[model samples]
Target: EPEVTQTPSHQVTQMGQEVILRCVPISNHLYFYWYRQILGQKVEFLVSFYNNEISEKSEIFDDQFSVERPDGSNFTLKIRSTKLEDSAMYFCASSRDRVDSGNTIYFGEGSWLTVV
Candidate 1:
């Protein structure tokens, strides 16, 4: 079976630093997304990417945050200036179907980001 894989399993940086989280989804699937999980809180959707543009995005995905599907295989999220509140576990996900459809979304182990 195929699964999503993320690089730099754990990342720590000072406040105001830049961070980039990378992911590779299942080879044959489409509809990619990024979700954030703050400690002890419900998972929150950050941004959704499809057909090379943003399909949906939450408030948390502000100017400080950006996403890209470079080379059509790897998806990346870049945080321009880290903040203390930015500390969380970021998950990379994908599905064969659209968000409203009854399709299974696969999640990566997560790229943990901590800001000090």
Candidate 2:
């Protein structure tokens, strides 16, 4: 089965530094999203992208964060500046249809980000 794929399984960065997490969702999927889970916190939705634009974004996606589909095949999340609170496991997901269409979303293994 096709699945979402992420790069740099894990990353360690210093506070104030920039970081970019990469993800490649299922080829046939039409919606892409970025979510993160702090060690003991709930999984939080950051942003959702479709048709080359963001469909939705959570409050967490502030001035320091951005998402983009630089190429037709890969989606990415960039943190302009890392903070200790930014440390978490970021997950990328995709679905064959719109989120409101009841399509099952497939997630990537995860990219663990550790900021110190």
Candidate 3:
């Protein structure tokens, strides 16, 4: 089965620094997303992309966060300025279609980000 893959399994950064997390979603999937889970909290949706544009986003996905599909296979999330509260496990996910359509979402192992 196809799966999402993420890079830099873990990263440590200073507050106010910028960091880019990379991902390769299932090749056949058309919808992509980014989610984050702070330690001890539930997973939160950050943003969703389809047809090369953002379909939806949460308030947490403010100006500091951006997503891009620079090439056909690579999707990336850039944090312009990291904050201590930004520390969390960032998950890259994808689905053949929207969840409402009954398609399942697949997630990567996640990139753990730590801000100091």
Candidate 4:
């Protein structure tokens, strides 16, 4: 089965530096999403994209963050300035359906971002 994949399973960065977390979503899926779990907290949605534009975004997706599909398979999230609070497990998910209830979203193992 095709699965989402993320790079640098773990990363450590300075508090103010920029970081780009990479993901390669499933080949045939159309809906893509980014979610983050702050240590023990529940997974929180950041943004969802389809048809090359953002479909929905949560408040957590603030000005410092942006996402792009740099190629047919690769999706990326860039944080312009990292904060301590930014440290979390960022998960990339993809689904066949745009609606959540219609299909199951598959998640990557997650890229653990650590800012100090």
Candidate 5:
């Protein structure tokens, strides 16, 4: 099966600093998403992008968070100002089609971010 890939499997950063986590979704997938799991907590959706625009976002994805598709293959998530509560495992996901259309979302191993 195809998969999404994320970089910097683990990173430690100071609070208030900025961080960018990178991802490469499956080559043919059209929808991209960013999800994060706080230690021992449920996975939460941050944002979703399709056709170069944000399709939806959760309250957790405030002004501090951003996503970008810089090229055909790369999708990235940027945290403008990291906070202690922002520490989590960020998972990049992709779907070949819309969820309502019966497509399954594939997730990457995840990039672990630890804020100090």
Candidate 6:
């Protein structure tokens, strides 16, 4: 089965530096989303994109963050300036079903970000 994949399962960066996390979502799926979990916290939604534009976004998706579908299979999330508080497990998910059903969303193992 096709599955979502993320690179560099863990990332370490200095505060204020820019970082880009990469993902390869499941092929043939239409909806994509980014979510983060700060160590012990509940997973929080960052953004969702479809049809090449953002469909939904949470407050955490501030100016410092942006996402792109650089190619047919790759999706990327860029953080303009990393902060210590930004450290977390970033997950990439995709679903063929609509958001209302919430069944198709499949999450990657996660890319752990650490800022110091």
Using all chains and alpha carbons, the TM-scores for the candidates as numbered come to: 0.96, 0.96, 0.97, 0.96, 0.97, 0.96
| lDDT for each residue of candidate 5 in 1-116, tens digit (9 for 90 to 100) | 77789998999999999999999999999999999999999999999999998999999999999999999999999998899999999999999998765788999999999999
Q: Lowest summed lDDT over 10 consecutive residues: which window, candidate 4?
A: 95-104
Candidate 6: misplaced stretches above 4 Å? none
Write one digit per residue (lDDT tens) for candidate 2, span 2-67: 889998799999999999999999999999999999998999999999999999999999999998
Clashes of 3: 0
Per-residue alpha-carbon lDDT of candidate 6 for residues 83-105, written as tens digits (9 for 90 to 100): 99999999999988666665668
Per-residue lDDT of candidate 4, residues 1-116 (tens digit): 88999997999999999999999999999999999999999999999999998999999999999999988999999998899999999999999887557688999999999999
**Global lDDT of each candidate:** 0.94, 0.94, 0.96, 0.94, 0.96, 0.93
The TM-score between candidate 3 and the true structure equals: 0.97
Error of 1 at 68 (Å): 0.5
Off by over 4 Å in 3: none
lDDT of 4 at 10: 99
Q: Report, for all candidates in order, the number of backbone clashes.
A: 0, 0, 0, 0, 0, 0
Report how far residue 44 has shifted in candidate 3, in Å. Answer: 0.2
Query: Cα lDDT for residue 73, model 6?
Result: 94
Those runs of model 5 whose alpha carbons end farther than 4 Å from true positions after fitting are none
> Which residue pairs come into collision in candidate 6?
none
**Residue pairs of candidate 1 with colliding backbone atoms:** none
